[model samples]
Target chain A: MTDPKTQTGSRQDEFEFFEESNALWWITLAPTTWAVHFVLAYGGTAVWCAKFGETQGVTVARLSIAGLTVLALGFIGWLGWRSVRRWKPRQNDMEDLSHPEGRHEFLGHAAFLLCIISAIGVVYVAMPALFITTCR
Target chain B: MIRSLAGSGRRLVAMALMMALAGCAGRQSALSPAGEDASWLHDLWIVMLVGAVILWTALNGLFFFVTRVRPNDWPERHANRLIIGGGVIFPTVLVGTLLAYGLSMMPHMRADGDGLVVKVRAEEWWWRVEYWPAGATAPIVTANEIRLPTGQRTELLLDANKYIHSFWVPALGGKMDMFPGRETRMTLRPETPGVYRGQCAEFCGPSHALMAFEAVILTPGDFAAWLEAEAAPAAPPATPEAQRGQTLFRDEGCGACHAVRGTEFDGLVGPDLTHLASRQSLGAGIMEVTREDLTDWIAHTRDIKPEVAMPAYDWLEAAELADLAAYLEGLK
Candidate 1:
């Protein structure tokens, strides 16, 4: 059997490397998608409205908004899927207070929850395009 | 204790009822919806209020149950489920549905450009109203009072000459901003024939609180008659005293700022006074349109409305002031 100390040292090294490399950026992946959706929706509508008066820019602006919404939803959904995969708990993760991978598991669980929320937010944000009649 | 609790509850219910009833009593009340747009807004407000009450009650009930009824520690999985379901799913669904419903109603609130159009310019402390009748070369210029045909959708082209202002007639429709160099539009279709009050919804200056106007909705025939009368020049001042007042109006340099059609005082710096006497109020609805009020406004405008653009004519003799008031009041 491998030495227990060596195993612990390797695990510590992995966690440190993960931290240094900023591998946990997936934690913010969901919110980042939301931010992108918000900016594009508002900015696209404003630019379209300014370029083509209220009455004319309806079609292109709305189509673009719809496309962006779908893209954001898909991206967040993929992130959620990855988070779910990462959140597979070890046998004693719940009961083992000193579990080495507990932090990673908790981060994965939080990221999954946030991704679900962000997906819902993306859908909610996109709802304006579905109903708002342009330049009315 | 039970009796006292019941009494307190009854009092609370009574207070709530009174508060709700108060919303319906004001002339400038969105709750007292007199048009289709205002009705939609009122209905939306009620829905949001109901949603808020439900959320408040549910959250407080949950809090009470968790703290007082069952104080045992919940399992981590159950807590997590509650957080995700309540914090994430519930609010997202609720707000999403509201946003969709609200956005869907936006088109109906806007005009189809199928009705009469009125151009309104917001100045420092007054409104310049121009009525665009069908097939008219020049818009019939008026001020302060807006006359509309009942049951007809009328569009207002709103602009600001100086600072930004907002046009709002709460009983009729939502507010639209008046931005400098940009014209915004809003439509109103009043269902009833009555006088409604409108106020400058945006704070623009020191006298913003006093900037108000009247919307007089009338039958089609009455509105046409009013428009015809409004389009005409003021009848020449009749009495010798009135004539003297007219001469004084010209001599006092009032012609530099005020315009009385059919007279030499064709100034555009101030409100048109061709039919000023016909209006319901003066100083933009701050005072009743009367000889006494007009005299007071002319003599002590600064005292009455602080920081208004019109300077006080306190130097005019009492008799001259009376003549000016009579001449103005006789224009109708």
Candidate 2:
């Protein structure tokens, strides 16, 4: 016969897995943003330097922005990985410990919302300014 | 593990197949060099590619063998020492040898003694080349096309008049950047008697993609004749259509973007049309100077080339277009 506590734990584990999976997907935002910024900044600067043959103050600014994106993305990936790894075990052992469902659920929801909002912002605000043609 | 080896082998095979396909396709681009320096560069690249293939195969083979043959939990706790020693020693030695070899090749690439000098200035969409011979007080300023005598070593002093750009001709040598405030030198000898096309390697603006030039290497006699022809003034048009076109050229403000020597047309914004009839292609090798192509281009340069600086002359009648085309073609 299965223990009632173990059954409850399995249910709680399922819920936590759902939330953590959502959070992990949400964490993809950090990497996506970083990658886009990196491509734009570095690629744009390279083009600018090549075309004009002069490195102005603006080129330095763009390159620095690219570097920062790399750093930020790497840090975010590390943090997200740590969070997900910790969450896996915590979800598995949920009913054994005190019910701490509220905090994990809230954070996961927040991350999901943030990701959606940022993605929308990128689509609406950034792409047009960066890619539209005016070459002469 | 076996899958990985298979995958790498597949990649190698795929690369080889692609190279074979490229060879068979016969899409010989016009911009490639047929000269000695270019051939040397190409050979060196092939050698390096072969070396890379061998190295990659050996490294991957070693990795595959080690992973496959050895158990995961081997008792030998540390192979880190050997790895660290090899990581430091081999790269240091290899890189040093490469640097030395590259340094040895540099002097030959940079001609030291007296050579033909061509000053190249990069604008937004065109190249202005000034050829100055040894002991000459004046230099011949030409646009788009650079004619050089075959077997003559020429040193190009390259710089951008407005922006950063790179000068490259695949058959001549590698690329060198043209900085706004700085000048970079490149040496090349066109040993072959053929046209070598080149483009602005750096992205400058919208028209950057279309920016192109050519090096027309000719026999000694032909080159001399070309030089003499270029030094002479613009000749009068022979045909009635050409005469009408010349009048149209004056009336229609064609003088705004181009310059034809010994005429009132003195606009420096575009290519010098002084010897327009002499060139094989119009608008810096964009298209052939055929009657229909010239009419289409002159009628609507913007339509043909969206980002071209030249405005369209769509207002002209068909008769006018033909006359203009005839006149421009007779500018030789």
Best by DockQ: 1
At residue B239, give the lDDT of candidate 1: 93
lDDT of 2 at A36: 71
Q: Fraction of the real A/B interface contacts present in each candidate?
A: 0.78, 0.00
Interface RMSD of 1: 1.8
The DockQ of predicted model 2 stands at 0.02
Roughly what TM-score does model 2 have, to 2 decimal places? Answer: 0.63
Model 2: per-residue Cα lDDT over B228-305, one tens digit each: 888677888889999999999999888987888888888988777887778767766677778998999999888777
lDDT of 1 by residue, B165-233 (tens): 999998888999999999888888887778889999999988999999998889889999999999898
Error of 2 at B146 (Å): 1.9
Docking class of 1: medium
Return the clash pairs for model 2, or none: A51-B164, A52-B163, A52-B164, A53-B164, A135-B206, A136-B206, B33-B171
In candidate 2, what are the lDDT values of residues A1-136, reduced to their tens digit? 9999999999999987897677666666654775676577557755765776343434354445545555555555555555555445444442433445544644443454344434333333222223322211
Best by lDDT: 1
